[model samples]
Target: MGHFVIPVTGKPVDYVAQIFPKNNLIDHGVIVENAEVYRQANSDKIKVYG
Candidate 1:
């Protein structure tokens, strides 16, 4: 099992959380102030800017 972190911007964090739950398989998302935090946490992270 792998981990993933998705930066939240523009859209509501709840909406993104709905799409990707905590215990789901294949996909997951999280909101962080900095993308580096995600990487530092040792999870794959994606940044969204808008």
Candidate 2:
């Protein structure tokens, strides 16, 4: 499986966790101040999760 790191903003980390299913989303948690990493499949067009 491919790996990727997606940066998210303006949204609760837990909410992101709930939105994206666990099967695809490996990690959806806070990385740093106002930043979160949504590790999933690599894609040229990433869904902007606010």
Candidate 3:
């Protein structure tokens, strides 16, 4: 959503999205169904999408 820059040895370069970034993710349903567990949340914004 935003542009970023990364510093190399010489100069800073534009940051690009990586295809194989290390991440921890889970099923969307688990998040939606257990939304209440997020104590500090905007309940109105939580939604389930197909």
Instruction: Write down the lDDT that model 1 would get.
Output: 0.43
Better of 2 and 3 by lDDT: 2
Model 1 pairs whose backbones collide: none
Off by over 4 Å in 1: 1-7, 22-29, 32-50
1-50 in candidate 1: lDDT tens per residue?
A: 55565544455433444444454533445554433222223245544544
How many residue pairs collide in each prediction?
Answer: 0, 0, 0
lDDT, candidates in the order shown: 0.43, 0.43, 0.23
TM-score per candidate: 0.26, 0.32, 0.16
In the order shown, the candidates' Cα RMSDs to the true structure are: 7.4, 9.6, 16.6
Question: Model 3, range 1-50, lDDT digits (tens) per residue?
Answer: 34323212221111211211323222121132223221112222334334
Q: Measured by C-alpha RMSD in angstroms, how accurate is candidate 2?
A: 9.6
The model with the greater TM-score, 1 or 3, is 1
Q: Which of 1 and 2 is ahead in TM-score? A: 2
